[model samples]
Target: MSVEPLIELKGICKNFGEKMILNDIELNIYPGEALVIIGPSGAGKSTLLRIIAGLLAPDTGEIYIKGQNRQGLIEDKQDPIGISMVFQQSALFDSLTVAENVGFCLYQHSKLPERKIRQLVEEKLEMVGLPGISHQYPAELSGGMRKRVSFARAIMSNPDDSRYNPEVILYDEPTAGLDPIASTVIEDLVRRLQQAAQVCGTYVMVSHQESTIRRTADRVVFLYEGQIQWEGKVQDIDITDNLLVRQFFSASIDGPIRVIN
Candidate 1:
């Protein structure tokens, strides 16, 4: 039997004032698959992720999480359900220690005791290869450390039968603004998380680094002009005879994707 799609988006349309950001976007994320989306700036990649996270409402179209409609969940009011995101900036609270930041969601949502939460938080930190840094504040950690903390927080939770293991984890520029070594570290952590979770959670990320995209993405969706212009695997990328794909992959300035004056 075929497994059901973990997330489905149909005919999604979004606009800011008169500018249309996304138009007729139809996509599906299956269980245990990592799908990476690569696109230039202002191509609606982040907006699409926000819509899936229920942080932004599309003017038209439908979003489904595990077959349940996500129309009513606003950005803040949406139940945690089984989704999470690691922002580009590693948005950790400066005042809170690493443990507190990782366990913040559990503190807010679950009635579990503080002791239990701390235990889980420590485990998550160790899983991400930062075992004893829980007492340190975000200000005390390095850029790569902060990203790992954010990643730990995103996946810190019980994977029980009743609660859905994250059906999707949307990563917004996971490797942006980092040194080459740091960027590789973040990419490797993503792979580790996928394997450790053992759940069929899909990953959809927006990134500019060619190395990260090649390492993590099973399939690539190239967005341009607010639409997907090319979709293919990493190997096919080299042989794709599409002009737009070639131009973007080669980082050539001459292409259908033009720089606005």
Candidate 2:
């Protein structure tokens, strides 16, 4: 891992009405390491992921992208590096074809010619194991296929500029709602992309699926009620005696985690 962090969160805090979603949170994402954030539903895992991606701002804190303090939201300030995010719902545009959806950013922002953009789109789709379907619409695909398309979109970058390529990605439940086999395929794809030259090796994911977390993460962080309760390597999950971790993995009703109705 690199000595300098690619992304950093310091004293992060967020609130919704009277409820606190994240409290004094701090995290660092290093290069070449895949980290997974896991916790019960409503544990603010996704919220934290969004904040890190700069899609949502924290109520109080600072976000540093590649050691430089971020000036504004992702759109406002062009950071030194790119940080991409894949939403849980596979948020593809219904009106656009797969190629258009994957290449939306480039189509709208880049000066690259249409032919070159199409070629890049095909390459990204192929990288995600969904080649030759660029002409199809998102509605024509299955849930898993749509998710993969979204993955391709998230990794899409302008070949003319390295700033468009993300050094870190945030995945919000990429494998959710898929069958076991489909989930495994997505999990494997995530790991494979980690090694791909076009994609960044470092990523942060928020997932509830045990297999996805275990298979994808080099390190794991457990969040509960707006705070980190436990964090360790993937191997530590099985041996950690932390009450929260044990209760979460075992799905037991009795523990420090409060059950909400």
Q: Which candidate leads the pack in lDDT?
A: 2
Residue pairs clashing in model 2 are none
As a TM-score, model 1 comes out at 0.94
Q: Model 2 scores what on Cα lDDT?
A: 0.92
Predicted model with the maximum TM-score: 2
Candidate 1 lDDT tens digits, 1-261:
988887889999989999989999988888788888888789999999888887888899998877878865555455435788889899999989999999998877787888888898998898889999999999988899999999888887763232534557889998888999989899998988888744325688988888999989998998877778889887888999988788877888887778655
lDDT of 2 at 87: 94
> In model 2, what lDDT does residue 54 have?
79
Steric clash pairs (candidate 1) = 32-200
At residue 193, what lDDT does model 2 achieve? 93
Q: What TM-score number comes out for model 2?
A: 0.98
